[model samples]
Each structure stands twice: as structure tokens, then as C-alpha cells.
Target: MTTKKYADFIYKQTKGVCNIMVEQMFSDYVLYKDGKRIGALYDNKLLLVSTENLNKLFPNAVQEKSFDWGYYKLIHIENTEDKELLEKAVRITYDDLYFQKDFVTDISYLFKVNKRYQDSITKIYNLHITFLRFCYDKGLLKINPLDKQDRILHMNFLNNDLTENGTKIFNELYDKWLVYTDKNDDKTDDRIVNTKMLEKYYLSIIDKLQINS
Candidate 1:
């Protein structure tokens, strides 16, 4: 059984990261960052989502099944007293869960296609939906996936938080959208076909990421 004192100690060790939250589950505790679950204190042990970056950071950390029936496993962190490492581990796990590295690589490929030839609106819309779905599934974003207005609001929030590369990518995508719209003359049939193709591409990326995760 895990004590509140031990759970509090674990939470304290990982306190500096932004939006870190914890919830008690009977005797154990689950940890979250930016609304995504990153780790937990179970049976007095610290268990974090296993990822390539995390594995490299703590090569000797023991990996174990999260549950008897689940395929996903977690890394058992032994040294909870090292506050800096604990914080780093939580951040790494959260990031890996939030944005799988391979997803970035796959999206970059789409960005490389000629702007004049790409279906920019379809691509952008699908990308937005894909991002929202991923975040929603991971408990990072809260909104009905089917609600257009809510999606628009949250997507705006995401756009506001874009990194340098992210901003550049969005700009390129917007330019492509303008080109596609001008060329297509707002044809519904053409838009539908483009949306279908982009949907398949985005879904494949999600499938690959989930399989690896």
C-alpha cells in the first residue's frame, strides 16, 4: 500500500513543471502534466510511461507492465529524491505522449509536397482534427471532437502556442490553402476527395504512433 506521505513526496519531486496535477486513487496516486497523465505512484513505486528518450535518460530503470492485461509498460523510477531528474522524467514522458517523434517526421513529409499541388484546406483541417483527437485521447485537451466551434476555439489556443518551426509550418500550410482554393474555385467534390486522402494519411500516422506507444 502507498501512503499519502510517499505520494506527496513523489509529487513534490516533480512539482516545478507546468500544470502538474495529481489525484489520489485509493492508496495510490496518478500524476498529470498539461492535463495528460505522465506517471503514477503505485504500491510505493514511481512508474512512468516508457519512451525512447526516457529509456536513454535512465538506461537502467526497470521496465514493467502497467497492468496484467495491457500491452503498454512503464519505467520504474527508483531514485525519487533526485528532484531535477524526477521533473525531467515527467516532462519527457508527457512530451513523448503528447507528440510522438514519428508523427512530426510524417507531418514534415506532407509539408514538403509542392504548395501549389497540395490540398491545403483539407490538409490543414485534417491536421487540426488529428491533433485534437490525439490530445483528447491522451486527456490533454478537453472538448467534444465533433463540436466545430469548440474545436476552432481550442485550435486557436494551439495556434497561439506554436513554436518557431510550428509557426513556419502553419504559414506554409496557409499559403498552400490559398493556392488550392484559388485553383479549385471552391469545388465541393474536389474538396471531398482531398479531405479523404488527407484523412487516410493522418489516420495512418496515428496508427503507427499508437502501435509504437
Candidate 2:
């Protein structure tokens, strides 16, 4: 299990130097740069991945073998407090492992993935509104467009259709929409027909109608 303190340490050490995000891989926290796996935190220690460029960058860097795998050699970072040294090691490893083509491809792939995810959420919301409209027509719902309270219930029903993060965002949007609607309910002149004219027309339409005698 990766500890927050250990993960935070690496994130802090590399702050403003390089783009990095600490992620857990197989119970070990690994650092990624431009979608490349560059380093890892194992047993509460930071280790830069062993690669040709890493070996070249730090010729005297100590290589330790993990007990999990006999042949796997990892460069353990002993001086955890040496920010400058740590940054240099990480920077060199990142540079060496960096590939322009792979970087561009990964970025494009990420964009496509995000776009598809957003589209799916939009589709879900469209269906959700359609379902709510049906319910409103059947006199089962009070709000046609749905209020936060109703939306929360609808979201729960379709929870499996969304990612955990997506659900949180959707809920937040629901709250915002509720607040906005509450604020603008009386201010906005959004009604199509005047209530007085509508009521009068409905009430007197039969009296004003001519019969074909």
C-alpha cells in the first residue's frame, strides 16, 4: 500500500521542475511523466526506473535488486532530502525515456478518450432528461427539467453508467443548476403565454365560439 506521505514527498521534490503525477501500480506508487512510467516508490523509497539513459546519466548510481523479482535492478534514491540531486536524477531519466512520437500519440489518445467520455455523459444526460420528461407527462414528477433532489435520485439509478469522478461532477452541476434556477425563477420572463389572457381565453372560448345553425 502506498502511503500519502511518501507519494507527497516525491510530488513536492519535483515541483516546478517537471510535470509528474504519482499513481499506484500493483500496490507501489509510480511516477509518470508525459504518460511515461519513469520512477516508482517502493517500500517507502523512491527509485528511478532502470534504463539505458538512466545508467548513462548516473554512472555510479547504486543498483539494488528487489526481492519480488531476482533479476530486476532498481536505482534506489538514498538522499531523499537532496531536492536538487533528486530533481536532476528524475529530469535525466525523463529526458532519456522521452520519445516525441510516443508523447504526441499519447496526448492525442488522451484527448480522444476524454472526448468520448464527455460524449457518453452527454448522451446519458439526454436520456435522463427524456426519461424525466416522460415521468412528468405521466404526472409522476413535479419538475419537468428536474430539480437537484430529483436529479440525485435519477443519477443514483444510472450510477453504473458513469465513472465515480463523473458522478461527482454531475452532482456538482446539478447543485449549480438548482441554485441558478432558484435565483432566476421569478426574474426571468420565460413564459410563452400571458397567464391572464390564457385563463380568460380558456374560460370564455366556448361562449365566443359561433355555431353553424
Candidate 3:
């Protein structure tokens, strides 16, 4: 069984790499970075998610099944005193899992909005808004794009932190919403069509940004 003291120790050791968080799961502790599970402390042992790069880096490290029925395995780091190696392993594992598996692709797949109305433009807009709000709620976005007060803050974050492609994607999405608001006159039943178009556009932007990142 894992104790809180040991879990806190492990978290303190690896937190310098990123925003590592520890959550109790029964008697063990699972670790997360930016809302993505990266590792865990099982049986008072530090176990990180097994990744190709991490396995290559630590060829002789012990491997164990993550759970009784799960196909995924975890790497056991025996040298708990070596904080440097632990941090490096956590960082590499996090990068591999987050960028390769759980980034924008998962977001798009998990939060896809269903088109229920054929002609209700407001409904389409609201559904898209819900998707963005979901992203914020899930800790994917630092600023809520739907909030008018967060407009400047969000733009500043894009300009300062994200890559050129990321910034462009966000700007294009924001511009699309702005255009929709500016031209509120609906002459035809194009809400469904526009909703599909916007969803595709949003996904493409995420994909491009992920590739560039």
C-alpha cells in the first residue's frame, strides 16, 4: 500500500519537471500532469507509464501490469533517491503520452457536439460554446474563449506562449465566432451546414497545432 507521506515525497521529487499532481486511488496514488495521468505510486513504489522512449532510456527497469485486466504496463523506478532520473523519466513519459495520445485528438473526439437542430443557428452556436466550455472545464484551455473579458487575456497567451500555428488556429476560430455574431441575420437554414463546417475547421486547427507543437 502507498502512504500519503511517500506519495508526497514522490510528488515533491518530480514536480520540478511540470505541474505534477497526486490523487489517492484506494490505497495507491495516481500522478497527473496538466490533467493527464502520467504515473502512479503503487505499493509504495514509484511507477511511471511505460513508453517506447522511456523503455529505451531505461532498458533494464522493471515492468509491471498497470492493473489486473489492463493491457498497459508501468515502469518501476527502484532508485527513489535519484530525483534527477525520476524527473527525467516523468517528463519523457508525459511528453510521449500527452503529445502522442491525449492532446487535441482526444479533445475533438471526446467533446464532439451532436447536431440536433436543422435550422436553429443559436442552438448550433450554443453547442459549440458548450464544447469550448468543456475544454476550459477540463483544464485544456487556460482562458475561456467565450468570455468577453478573457478576450485580451486569451490573445495575449496565444501571442506569448503558443507557437505560430497555434496562434493562427486560435485567431481563425475567434474570427469565425466574431463573424457569426456580426452577421446575425439568418436568411436560410444553414445552421447545420455551418455547424459541420465549423467543427471540421476547429478540428483541423487543433490537428495542425498539435503537429506543429
Candidate 4:
């Protein structure tokens, strides 16, 4: 675990050289530069992110494995009073990992499209409800939110517009919501609950993907 003091020290040290953001992950703090992860602060030590490029650059850097699938070299920045050295190390790592454009922009754009599609589908579904209400008011057609048109519109939106991963996530949440619906008999109300759950999931995935970029 990274203490707040240690994490702040590393973050403050790199201030003039580049922008760094610290993220808390299961009690440990990981640092990112330009939307790309640069290092992690674990056990009060700052270690540059391990990669083939980093390995080549610092061959003698010790290999410290933090988990089953990953390890990184000690950047020798821990508790050091040498600001110049700290600044230089941060600059090199940031420059090496930084890209011309951050991938977050693309993810944001993708979600914007997804949001537009979701909004359009919702409007259409509401329009159908309004039409059905108008018809019923005029004694033309009796309808509810679960009418045939509603089902068809929902299925088309799910199958055609949603990506495979998105579909999988939605299906999983939908299955759970199905259980809730079975017990409570209120599917429409649970839709809001499921939507909130999906929003959190999507945000987490986007953050992970952006950091990995």
C-alpha cells in the first residue's frame, strides 16, 4: 500500500517536468502521464512501468514482481533528495510513454455516439408510447410500454447498435435484473437501477482502457 505522503512526494516531484495523475487501486497508488500509465507507488517506492522498452533502457534495473502477471524496475526515486535526478527520471519516462494523442478522446467519441443512439432509441420508444396513448384516448388502439412495438424496438437497438462486448455486459445485467423483476414484478423501475449499474461499469472500463493506452 502507498501512503498518502509518499504518493504526494512523487507527484510533487514531477510537477515541473510533466503532468502526473495518481490513481488509487485497491489501496495502492498508480501514476499516469498523458493518459498512459508511467509507474506505480507501492510500499512507498516509485517504480517505472515495466515494458520491453523500459527493460532495454534500464537493463540493470531490478525486477520486482507485484502481481501474477506484472513487474517493474525500481526507478530509484524513493526518498531521494536530488530533485534534479527525480525530475530527469520523470521526464524520460513521460517522454518515452507519451503519445501524440491520448486514446481517451477516441473512447469519449465512441461513447458520444453510443449516447446519441441510446437517446434516439429512448425517444422513439417514448414516441411509440405517446402514439399508443393517443390511439387509446381516441378509442383506436390499446397499448402499454410492453407492447409489440416496444419489444421490437428494444430488440433491434440491442442487437444492431450495441457492440458484442456491450451486448454481453447488458445481457449479464439484464439477467440479474430479470431475477429482481421476477421477485418484484417491476421491470420498468429496475431499468433505472440497471442503467446506473451499466454507467459505472462503462466508466470503469473506459478508465482502464485509457490508462492502458
Candidate 5:
């Protein structure tokens, strides 16, 4: 959707042609063949992961951008696009864990040219994931030559000492995000989950919260 070329390692590695980036369903991305989604995008490039993975790598990845929810988990990926800063950013983004809806309490980073937002709960989380998806889509966080070790940083932070108030604040903010998302999106039982986009925001908020916490 963006004109700017993202920092994608897959594009660099395969010269812009990778069919099944993930092991499971190729739904995260619509692979372009002559500009059409023949399948999904999952390579060493980026893929979906679990909530536990989110927390383990979030601190090191998106240290500059984080949020709250206390779930502390994320997916793992081996960035090999040659952009350390961007890979660091993506590592910080919980790119594959947004489908659960058990965590994630904010979405206000979509239009975040500035740190603080006016909408607080609803806008923060929504915008945050939106921005991550945009970055991923536009290859803003793609890195090259991702080391084998770089893909596995699943160290849990739950045992670490997070402030009681910080935890409370995280929950409060996250709750606001939930309400906002429900209000804006359909509240039907059959609602669909956009995990790709969720991954972006999940990591973004986790990164933000770590700093503010």
C-alpha cells in the first residue's frame, strides 16, 4: 500500500519473490505475482508467533516503542535483510501475536508522529498496530542477513520486577483499547482477526510500555 520500499530481507534475498513465508496458512501477506496475491508471505522475512514469544523479544526489539497488557509474549523471526535498526524495531514489534485478543490494550500509534496521543486508550493501540503493519508492509523494519540466534530471543519478563502501579496502569490502558476496538469494529461473534496487523501493534505497545513503565 505504500510507495516506499521497506527494509525487507526477503525482497533482498529472493529479489522480491517468496511464496510461503510461514509454515502455516499464508494469510499474513498476499504474495504478489505480477502484483497479485498468489499465496501468503512467510520466509525468514516475517511470520506469526505466539504471545509468549512476544514478551521474550519485545524489550530488545522495540525498546523505543512499547505498550501494556501484561501478557509479555511475541513471535520469533530471523531478519536477514541487512537493516539492524529496522530489525531491532521489528523484533520490538510483536508481529505475530495479535490474533488472541487476550493481551493488547492500546492502539494509538497509527498516526503517531508525536509520542503522546490525544485519544489515550482507543487510539493508541489501534494506531500503534496500524503503524506497525504499515512499517512491515512498506518494509520499514526489514533487515538483512539475520543471524540464526537473532530469530530466537524468547526470554520471559514476567518474573522480572514490574511496578505494581505499572501493571495496573497497563491493564487500565489495555482495557480502554478493548472498549475502543469493540466500539469501532464489528462486535459480532463471527468477527475476523487480522493477525498480521495485530503483530505490529502488539510489539509496538509492548515496547512503549516498557519504556514508560
Candidate 6:
């Protein structure tokens, strides 16, 4: 709902930017002015310098309304997306704004929302990967659900841009995998012992997924 293109916004303001991600977080980042902090934005809210410092610099700065979105507290940060103004935010807030809640993402929700595109994943894969690879990469299949031929045919599902639902499903599965792996890890463990074992059974998982030339 935010017309804001966060990556483009930041890039326009700071040309030497790093990788851009939406719905993720970065720990306390600083703005350098001869190596000094002036202001900060956190969880996307702009906080100003100390009460006194903020008054001195941005005398007219005031609270703005959070944006309207169903089931989410998405706020529109005005004039503050750019660096010049944002620098002052860090010095003022003492840190970026941290929310008690995290961004919401559910893959099932996406599937339901885009029900019209029933096999959107298949379509995206078809448009991109060769049918063979598309069948191989661009899908969300169960780990136990795949046969060698199934894997070979579905690898192209990976090439699909992924409906919001697919992404959520992938993330949920991945998060569970990470937790399971980490919990299984004791000392100096890669944490995916269980998965690695599964890999032995599916070693040729990517064999069917020939990359497009």
C-alpha cells in the first residue's frame, strides 16, 4: 500500500548503498558526519536528536500519521526516507525505532489472495525456464513428496518469481528447517544433519534442473 519503493528511495538518496531487502531488519546502523550520529529511523519511524538537540536542528519536526493497511501498522515516513533528513533522526532518537511486532507474511494468505492464478507458480516457471527445468526448479513440493523424476520435472519452480503465498510458504518451511537444524546442532554442527541425510536420498535433486543457456 505504500507507494514508496524503499530500495529506489534509499538508492536515490545514497548512491553507495548495499543490498536492499524489504520486511527484514538491520541492527543499529549509524550515519557518519565526520564520524558522528545525528538522527535515526528504526522499524521505519524517524526519531530525532535529543529533545533539545532536535529542537535546535529541526524546530518544525513533528509526528506524522501511520499509513492505513488492513491488519498491519504500515506507516508512511515522509521527507525522512532520504539521508540528509534521516541522519538527524539517528542523533535524535538515540537509535532507530524498534517495533514490538514484526512484519506479517503468510504464504497461505498469498495463495488465497491470488486464487485466480491457481497455478501461478507453474505459469511463471513456464514463462522463464525451459519446461524441463521449469518442472524442476519452480515449485513448492514436500521434501518427502518428491521422486527423482518429480524433482527433475519441478526444478523450474525455483525460477518462478513466487506468488506472495509461495514466498511465505518457502520462508515458513525454511524457518522450520533452520530451527530444526540449529536445534539438532550441538557442537560445531552445520545444523542440517537431518536434511543432509535426506540429501543422500535425493542427491540428484538438481540433476533435472539444467540451467537455461
Please provide TM-scores, in order, for all candidate models, with all chains considered together: 0.49, 0.42, 0.49, 0.39, 0.17, 0.22
Worst ten in a row by lDDT for model 5: 152-161
lDDT-wise, the better of 2 and 4 is 2
Instruction: Please write out the lDDT profile of model 4 over residues 31-61, one tens digit for every residue.
Output: 7875667777778877775545555555667
The local distance difference test score of model 2 is 0.54
lDDT of 5 at 114: 36
Off by over 4 Å in 1: 65-69, 100-213
After TM-score superposition, what is the CA distance of residue 74 in candidate 3 from its true location, in Å?
A: 1.1
Sorting all predicted structures by lDDT, with the top scorer first, yields 3, 1, 2, 4, 6, 5
- Model 5 C-alpha lDDT per residue in residues 1-213, reported as the tens digit of each score: 211132243344444232322122332333233332222233323322333444464434322112221443223344444445323333323223222212332222333543554443434434434433333343333322123442212211221212333333334443443443453444422221344434444456657666431
Q: Rate the local accuracy (lDDT) of all candidates.
A: 0.61, 0.54, 0.64, 0.50, 0.34, 0.36
Query: Which prediction has more favorable lDDT, 1 or 4?
Result: 1
lDDT of 6 by residue, 69-185 (tens): 233222223565558665444333332222112232333443465568755543332222222232124443322223454332323233133433333343444444434433322
Q: Positional deviation of 85 in candidate 1, in angstroms?
A: 1.1
Cα displacement (Å) at residue 168, model 4: 44
Candidate 3 accuracy as lDDT:
0.64
Better of 1 and 6 by TM-score: 1
**Could you give me the TM-score of model 4 versus the true structure?**
0.39
- Per-residue accuracy of model 2 over 1-213 as CA lDDT, tens digit each: 668888898889887565677888787787888667777788888888776867876677777666243344678777778888777778777765563222111112323454857744443344345444433443333334466554524322233333333233333333333233322235323222123433333234324443111
The C-alpha RMSD in Å for every predicted model, in order, reads 14.5, 20.5, 12.0, 16.4, 20.7, 17.5
Worst 10 residues of 3 by lDDT: 102-111
To one decimal, what is the Cα RMSD in angstroms of model 6 from the true structure? 17.5
Over 85-159, each residue of candidate 1 has an lDDT whose tens digit, in order, gives 888888888777774322222333444564565566465555456444544443333344436553434333343
Name the lDDT value of residue 137 in candidate 1.
45
